[model samples]
Target chain A: MKLTNSMEGVTIVETEDIKAKKPVVLCGLPDIGLIGIIAVSHIIKELNMKEVGYVDSDIFPLIVVFHHGEPTYPVRVYQKDNLLAIFAETALSPESVHPLSKVIVGWAKEKNSSLLVSLGGIGVPNRIDIDTPRVYGASNSASLRESIKKYEIPVMEEGFLVGPYALMAKLSMHSDLPNLLLMAESYPQYPDPGAAAAVISALNKFVPVNVDTKSLIQKSEEIRLNARELMRKTSENMQKMGKSQEYELPLMYV
Target chain B: MPAQKRMPIEPADTWSYGVMWDHISGCLEPLTEFHDKETELMIRIDMPCVKRKADVEVNLTEDTVAIEAKMNRVVQYEKWGTFQREAKFFRYSKMFTLPAKIDPDHSKARFKDGILELHLPKKERRYSVKVE
Candidate 1:
């Protein structure tokens, strides 16, 4: 935990306890709202990256220098305009997407990321809010689409995206850096183990991990039941409308 | 006494009995206003995990607008008090009051990326004739 005189309250986050590897994948999202935060944490644990020093937000240009052991690949930290940006061969944890996706994508392109995939979720109505969640995928890059298509993950045909997902799409387009977004339907505004399980499934196809999803399934009911009351209000808000439901493959458990 | 700013209309307590517990609450920051010659309203919502457009649902009324967006389920690591789904969201639901009557059939909505935008057109106003 290091503070810098560069800027005011910007705290840079990196990790230790990792396996050095290349072609690293990084994730971010809209805000502390989506489960990207959790995805990143799992990525950190799955990949096991050594923690470098903190990069103060005040620093110009995204530069992540480890005060300790040198990282496998160079990581940079700074801001892209007002958004907080970080670039590393290593990915961050908790995968929380923030408004800074625009910033981070730029950093990824600079590092010439072979591929960048941002994982996130959406809350739905008219469903059981089950433990086994399904996932969908989208890509601004054709290669990404081709690789992910074998999994039979649905492609995003339409819709609006904001914050990190939106920015990541835009930056990748501008830089010609291929980016894909894998989203799973989750409980609105509450933690969802089911959605996380779906992400882990998709990531496993690419990131290569040894973690077991069986453990996460147990947390499904725990998290789903945990938010029953608040979900009731959301239910009331949704009842005014009527429509059919959508489905994804099982990611968590029955 | 100092005057404090007033917040927009709060979500009604007894919302439709539907299973609304899926969505978190007011996460996507809404826009300041949506206006056309016929109608105008303010909307801002956050749907963190939506990968494609087919995952959301929207409905509108003369005085109300209800939205249901499916959040991609991602577990957040730490308890940050407000967020749960991977810290992005569980779901997002918000209702709005229209300044004028709206034609639900004539309105339009678009969700690109993860944000959902709704365009509601106002119903024509009828002048009341007073007989003296």
Candidate 2:
């Protein structure tokens, strides 16, 4: 197999279902990588789609393949007459995300992705603990915005996301693909399945995926407690070395 | 330097992790409840984030009680950003080693008004029953 330094205009990962029909792209990074992963994975599992392949990368942001395993990116596709592409990635350092722009743009073009949606989380202090997370929506095209607006979700007022997901949103706009980003009130610094579930609820309108929402809601405490313990260990380790992993937490505006 | 000056600018213990968690331990509210029959063990989870009871997950086994929630947070916004990039989520996970044996097969769980309640049926207490 030949390799490329970056996301190529054509896919190096061959499709086993090439002759089946048009494809809907849905992706996720998993609940651990970022908050968005849980959302995208929820859609994928709820939709009962097949595990195709992954865009492998051993870089700072890991992207491994899946056969019968969990997805890492909260970005995926639910196929129908209209294809929906979910753009979800762990919100990490900006420099580490530059490659995302290159790869996703190429992937979108090569895959002919028509509609793209990037789901993000905006951390808020007050949202540290709650049941029903709130979400806001935005789009690359006005019509796409209208589509999401039909659900009465709040528009992503005035803010920015800087990473592969954001890059894809920007690239999709210029690439002729109608793109959008649905952001939620997330503890950007923490693994927020609640936020992810909320965003997924808002998104179920377009792609039509069915998620029970019960499991995600029920497991919230377990998720929080585990996260707390992890943080305690990390904080202790950081202190012992007189250093910190600043990149471990999410950056929320609220 | 005086004792006051000797304090570190940021205490590591004060931080949950180097990343710091969103839900504060102090903010954690107490969750306790009572049940009627000997069959149900009233379970009250402190979830200020969840709005609807339908979003909670509860599972019971012969000797275990597993519950999960993606609780919602009361949201507010402020516009001060120190970084312009990605986010890290401190996911919540708590595994409670139950103190009693529970009926893993037959159990009732409900989420009402943001609170998740589980009625874990105690085994036939074979001793708690009588016949005429």
Candidate 3:
């Protein structure tokens, strides 16, 4: 519970000492369709990961997530072996996206992580018609782009990505950090466990987590029902951040 | 100084799934989005666990739309948040007030993959004039 406030507006509280050989840093902030939150949460539970640290900031909503009887930070860091996952249980405001992304990238660099992966969703209006949600990959460096190609994943060649993942990618690039963004086609304002499962399946190809997605698919309805509130709040924040820009074609591309 | 008539400002409906008592009421409010298009107001509601279109009921007025949907089965949660008690919900209900007047008679709706989309055309059409 030792909260160390940083000038970046994010306070990281490390409850346990973490030691690993080039761990992979995964971020699952509340974004479109709650894809990151659902995907990372499922991975955390399935892997039985332990909470190592938590991030707090004034820009974040004043709320505490209660699990069982213990009060937990809304944004927490969980780790198992060499894999570290940072996820938020609540929606984040637009103003917090930049500072939080910078803090996370800086922390990941300090930890000497091998790769930073961001799980998210690309909002598609026709997501209802889509059965198998497609995952698109975007990278910060050429090496990561080559890694994405090795997996046969479609590269996001042209589009504007907004929100936390967008900020994370930009900051990671500036820091010379290898960052990977996996986004699935998802409803803009609904909790999409289906899309999360698709992303997790793609992630297992590279990360080797080997998590069974059958349970995730089976419990999709329940997750959607339970996550309605967070999805609503996240959708509002997405609108404020001009997330619709992602759909518009960039003039530079033309 | 003339006293101006005050137009009523409708409060936006906030839906959340964090309430433990939401299930006890036998109904849960689904998350909804209302978009004001150029010619129509599009309303989308997330109503998962609904098996078929027959399970959903939508009622629309000039400025308000009400939705009630029955879940295929009782959704039970063993422990929600810090609450240790079990909770069960069987239905989803919500009402949305649009910003502009709509033609309820011309409104059309479609339900697919647990999402209900409503297209309500505006009663009055908007016109643009070209600059000379």
Where in model 3 is the C-alpha error above 4 Å? A1-7, B1-24, B76-88, B100-106, B125-132
Instruction: Single out the weakest 10-residue window by summed lDDT for candidate 3 chain A.
Output: A1-10
Candidate 3 lDDT tens digits, B1-132: 111111222233134323312644767777766677789888777888998999999987887777889999998878754446787888887766667888999999999888999899989977899999
- lDDT per residue for candidate 3 within A1-254, as digits (tens), equals 55533536787777888787899998899998899999999999999999999999988899987776678899999999999999999989988888888888888888888889999998887787899999999998898789889988899999899988898899888988889899999888889999999999989977999898899989998899889878877888988999989889888834
**Share of real interface contacts recovered by each model?**
0.00, 0.00, 0.72
lDDT of 2 at B26: 18
Residue A170 alpha-carbon offset, candidate 2, angstroms? 1.3
lDDT agreement with native, every candidate:
0.49, 0.50, 0.84
TM-score of chain A of each: 0.61, 0.69, 0.96
**Residue B90 in candidate 1, Cα distance off native in Å:** 23
Better of 1 and 2 by lDDT: 2
A211, model 3: CA deviation in Å?
1.4
Tell me the lDDT of model 3 at A231.
85
Q: Which has the greatest TM-score?
A: 3
User: Model 2 over residues A1-254: C-alpha lDDT tens digits?
Assistant: 22322553212232233322333455443222245666665556666655333344344344432333543432222333334334333333334344655665566556665555666665554452455677878787888778767888887655545445666677776777766677778653345677878877876876666677778768765554334433333223323432223234455657
TM-score of 3: 0.87
TM-score of candidate 1 against the unseen true structure? 0.45
In model 2 chain B, which range of ten residues has the least summed lDDT? B1-10
Which candidate, 1 or 3, would have the higher lDDT against the true structure?
A: 3
Instruction: Order the candidates by lDDT, highest first.
Output: 3, 2, 1
Candidate 2 off by > 4 Å: A1-12, A18-22, A29-33, A58-93, A225-254, B1-132
